[model samples]
Target: MKMTEVSFDIETVPSTIRYYLKNATFYDSSCSDNAKTVFVKGADGAFLKISKKGSLEREYRMSNFLSTHKVAPKVFAYESDLENDYLLSEAVSGEDGTSELYIENPNKLASVFGEYLSMLHSLPTEGCPYKNRTAEELNELTNKEASLNILTEINYSAIDDVIIHGDYCLPNIIMDNFSFKGFIDLGYGGIGDRHYDIYWGIWTLNYNLKTDNYKDIFLDAYGRSKIDRDGLTYFTQLIKLCD
Candidate 1:
């Protein structure tokens, strides 16, 4: 990963499926892009972030705001594509949350992320009008019968009211040896319920960490009741199956 540069490589099955060059350029609808992209290229490298215009605007706001709140890549400029509209930005350096942290020393893992999530949750929820990703909203989003039954069985409001990553999975979080560098993909991040984030953390530590003790260690550190385990588990699945 290169810093203070506009070029970036996209990661995919083939290692690098594509790349973008960003150079303080704004959106342009006349370009050969239907998918809006923010392109920049500097001495280090180049990168392109592809997204719809609305999503690009939202991501730009998030990238700016989140950088101040936590760790996020900086934005040089953004513009609409010639054929489509996609957003782009400079890439930040660091590993995602799906690091060895989840596969090793779960107590340490939970303790580390537990503190971060707690810190985010402890913030005052004022002036933020975003709603939590509740099971209700999830149901409305998807109507597949197989998925609906699974969602209906679980109660999403049991342990609600925390700043959920919205997509609190391993990949969204970035870390380096128990050290949290920052978070990415804040598409769903907002002042929602803490349980949303905690549930994923708890589940990941327990299942991926493959430790029976993780459930207790996480609950103790997270300062929540184990009684909400069922809800957390159900909601975690619901979050995973979300479109």
Candidate 2:
């Protein structure tokens, strides 16, 4: 959410997206350790993300898929060579959920956040390309330093499959005028467990607002009938271990 004005050599950008960056001012908008995101400021704004080669393939695919549902920005180009991957996408127009405007109204923000997440989960997933998220997380846990008994306590079968935002947090959910715009940072997104997204939704509210008072409000807006409180707790702990 903190974007600092900075300079970047456009020559380093992949030729496929270089045209978009020419003569544009650059801002260091990166938040993740895995990628560097430059916000290109101009009449036609865009975001240029750079990472190791092959690292952004899943993101590219998922972004394009989400665009079809009008819940994400359109991907302009995805190109990679032997050394690095580059993704250029049109910027979604809005301030993210972490903006002071939204933070000032915790009640409305929590309700809108939950409503949008429920809408995302309700999207049909007939042809989703990424469906092995649960398996992948379980695989990750296998290499973790957890005790065997603790690992056995995780009930993988209890997870409900739904298209998840993967890293669903306040900063990733964009909004304008208190209305939902779209989501960003979708590299881990795909058809996965809904609890993963739910867990982060709750976590982000607490992390950003510095309070847990909105948890019940969020769950209620998201429809508590669809939630399993015990499963949410279990998956939350399981995901923390994987992280």
Candidate 3:
């Protein structure tokens, strides 16, 4: 994942870390070489984005991944510099949907997230042009064996054939009020089941974490009495292995 130093004259504008880049360890090599993402105000009163190399290729490849959804940040371009990669794009208009509003108002969390996530899953999967994952696909993705009974035990039969936001948790969900802008990190956005989205969304809240009542609130908001809780439990355990 290293890039050969090339003297590509792309005078990168100065940047700042408006917030923590999701993963610190791979912030450069695994995430972005110029991992310090910034929010700069332009003369026109709009925020412009500037990114440096690292995992630009992988990120760029998934640039269009979340385009179908109206909520994602609009990407401007990804071009090769002398010896590195660079990404330019428009900034998201609002704060992350998982902001103070939702956190402080935890009860509003599930209902808003429920309907928003459903909209994401409802996107047409036919011409998605992205990889769709299954239990078997996941198996090939890791050293641990993925289980097929994940759906059955989790009671996930009701929802299928929709896009699964691999990281459907809060951070990735950007919003201003109830207006969800779009999704980010298309790197993992692809076709799958409805439960996958809901499962992770509730698990990672870290607030009502480890509590079934909080998760139930989300389901209640989503208007569902039955879901594959077992499947979510399994995935949560699986994700823990990743940590």
Top candidate by TM-score: 2
Which is superior by lDDT, 1 or 2?
A: 2
Error of 2 at 236 (Å): 1.7
Q: How accurate is candidate 3 locally (lDDT)?
A: 0.55
Give the CA lDDT, 0 to 100, for residue 170 in model 2: 92
| Candidate 1 Cα deviation (angstroms), residue 53 | 5.3
lDDT ranking, high to low? 2, 1, 3
lDDT of 2 by residue, 1-243 (tens): 789999899887778788888889999999889899999998788999999999999999999999899999899999997899999988888899989999999999999999999999999887777987777777776756563346567564545478999989999988897778888888999998888889999999999999999998999999999887667866777786776
Q: lDDT tens string, model 3, 94-213?
A: 556556666777667667777777777667776665555555345554565444444235543333477777777776676777577767655565666566677677776654433555
The residue pairs found clashing in candidate 2 are: none
Whole-model Cα lDDT per candidate? 0.56, 0.87, 0.55
Candidate with better TM-score, 1 vs 2: 2
Q: Which ten residues in a row have the lowest lDDT in candidate 2?
A: 147-156
The C-alpha stretches of model 2 lying farther than 4 A from their native spots are 143-148, 151-156
In angstroms, give how far residue 167 of model 3 lies from its true place: 0.8
